[model samples]
Target: MRLDQMSGAKLEQDGSSWQAYAEQPLTFQFSFGDLQTNQDKIAVFVRSVENGQPEAWVQASDGEYQLTLAQPGHYTFEFKARDQAFNYSPVTAVDVTAIPVPAMISVPLLGEVEVRIFQLLVLFGSLAIFGFGYVSFEIVQHRRRIVAAVERGYNPYISGEPVRRVDMFFGRHDLLRRIVSTLHNNSIMIHGERRIGKTTLLYQLANALQEVEDEEFWFVSVYIDLEGTTEEEFFHLLMDEIAQTVRELPELAPEQIEILNGLLNLHLAENQYTDREFNRDLRQIIHILEEYGAVQHRGCQVRLILLMDEMDTLSRFNHLIQQQLRRIFMRDFAATLGAVVAGIEISKEWERVESPWFNLFNEIAMAPFSTDEAIQLLTEPVRGYYMFEPDALDFIVEHSDGRPYRLQQYALEAVNQMLHHKRRVITLADVLVAHELIQLSGQQPKGSWGEDAARGELGVPQTPAPAT
Candidate 1:
């Protein structure tokens, strides 16, 4: 007898007594031969030992048999072949050892509960690995993009300082036009809260005065910052600024500048310079300017406009000192000398009916930017370098309450957020991030957003935006 075509079993040795190792279920084919009888007359009988079942000789007419070893044990099968005359051949036996599958296999000997726990652990572990890999990839890509945006240098907002560049200034068109049209004959007073662009407007007015093309009047604008001036040094500082400004005029010759300097030095000396002396020296300076304008500008009159900033300090002086200033503007020099004073508020002393400054000049109140102005301010500064989504622009405008300073602060932080995320188009989510950062640092705006507080600290540089 020969065993062949075995599956799920590996034969250890080849002989009449065969030993094999297998994992159930195992199957094999057998064949028997007799010299005196035909192949069909042959019969094979099999019995098992120590297989956890009843042992008996079972006649197997077929040439194939199968064994299912449900338990781990040593199993033996004895086989005998019988010829047609009932003659029996020598017995052949095969031994097999059934063993447990590897623990790494899909199914193990663990109970049903343990099997479910193992399956759940595998599923959760796979999810965690996938999640970790996905997050790592996103972080790497974000870092690469930030590096690229930084290399491009795309910041275009200003904060924490006054705007100095003319192109960077926005809005105030009607106010500027009105101020210029009446600046020749009328003195103007500009009053507004702090950080409302008062200083910037004064600088703009000076620049605008230089560009005005007047046929009859030569406009010479002199800027005087009265931030720390006292009543004692008032006349001295005024003469000094006048002399410095007049010396820079291109039309004045060297000898003419020397004469103007000499006149200014007379009142700027250590002596107690009174308003009368100031008036005298200013009269002489105006005569010099008028003569120069006559000869060089075809007889145009000389109009000297003083753009004084930080005038709030003047309120600390006594009413008499304020009267002296009003007297100087109310004299004959009123025709040739004009004043544009800017401050946070007009002194209460000036509101009195009989006060010297009660009706001295035309007052223009400063206001926050309008919606259209805010849009222009946000977009024009970064027209080509970056862009703002419509909702982002609306978010800034609505939260900032159309205040130029707050608008700049919001824009500064929002652009920083965009740079951090390496984005060119600013979105509402970026604005929300900026708001959260500002709130965390206790720099959020007041009035519209919350209680009254001092202005926020926004430390962005004041560089001019790139030209469109």
Candidate 2:
């Protein structure tokens, strides 16, 4: 006998329900009749898409189930359901309307949490992009400005950049006066190490004597460097200077010009005519200068200041060559020309010539700037355009060994750090940073504190963030 079966289903909101149908395939077939309500509907039937053995028979049976309408769509449930006699139900179909309910989101906390997390990520991501762009722009602009300024040769430390003056002056009063008096009768040797500003000091001495109006001294200063110079080139350059000086002097008549000129060329030229010929030329140039002074006829003192920088270069030659050059200065040129020979402590070869008249030359040593001088060098003339804090000036001077090169290097680097780091008021910490960068780059910055001392000396204050 055929088992006649019926199945029903329902859905609840306020515990209300809707009834649905179950099917029996062994009996009559059911059709999807027209419904009246405007709601979504679904029909579920079980059928194995593949035909096989008993596994296919189980898959073809419609299983026992409940109606679970989640959304407004059609769904099909395919499974097996066995009856009491262990006979599986045949594939069946049922259709019902599911009244659409407003979706009440179940996870209120989780939904809100996801939205908040998304908002935070977007906010932080935007901030990161903006911050990176701003920093990059600043770096580019700063580099551009630095390149432009360097091209213009604008030094930030000192204001009023002057043209490269051949005659740069320094300050020394009584010492210059005594040097001038000595140079009038003697050729002095200026002794100093490199970068001690001896060349500048000599220029100042020359300027001082030149500025003396009431003194009847006609000062003619000639500066030369013997470094990389041959004896021929050395004397040749000196002759050019002396000839130009004689040509420009108003005290000497034009009629005397050729006599002096001829005399100079004769002595200044290659004297293959032997040592006697070379000495004759040297003595002729010296005699002409003395004659020019004597011809002034009004008791005029024609003083010639011959300033030789890097006199140590003469040592590169044989001792005899250096001795020959010294003979001219010690004997003949000593009477008419005031000579300032500048070199380091090792430049003794210039004075080692066997001439007792070397006693007439005074040896002046150039030392590094004093503390007060270094301070003045750092602060003055740069007061308005730039400034240093009270302790900042002292800190730089103390650490710079009173060396001008290092003083400027430290100050310029400190300024760079302050600008680069966007710090308004420069501190000792900035100095330390600049120092370390210079050291790491293999630059031995003067007065540089070691790492341990720097860490101990410049203790920066840490700022705490505000409590949220």
Which candidate ranks first by TM-score, i.e. highest? 1
- Residues 174-206 of candidate 2 have per-residue lDDT tens digits of 456777776656667777756656665665665
Which portions of model 1 miss their true places by more than 4 Å?
1-152, 264-271, 347-349, 443-462, 465-468
Q: What is candidate 1's TM-score against the reference?
A: 0.62
131-210 in candidate 1: lDDT tens per residue?
99999997886655444434444455655566667888887778888999998789999988777888888888888988
Candidate 2 positional error at 287, Å = 6.7
- List the global CA lDDT of all models: 0.75, 0.52
TM-score of 2: 0.51
TM-score of each: 0.62, 0.51
> What shift in Å separates residue 159 of candidate 1 from its native position after superposition?
1.7
The parts of candidate 2 lying over 4 Å away from their true place are 1-178, 214-216, 245-253, 256-298, 346-360, 418-430, 443-468
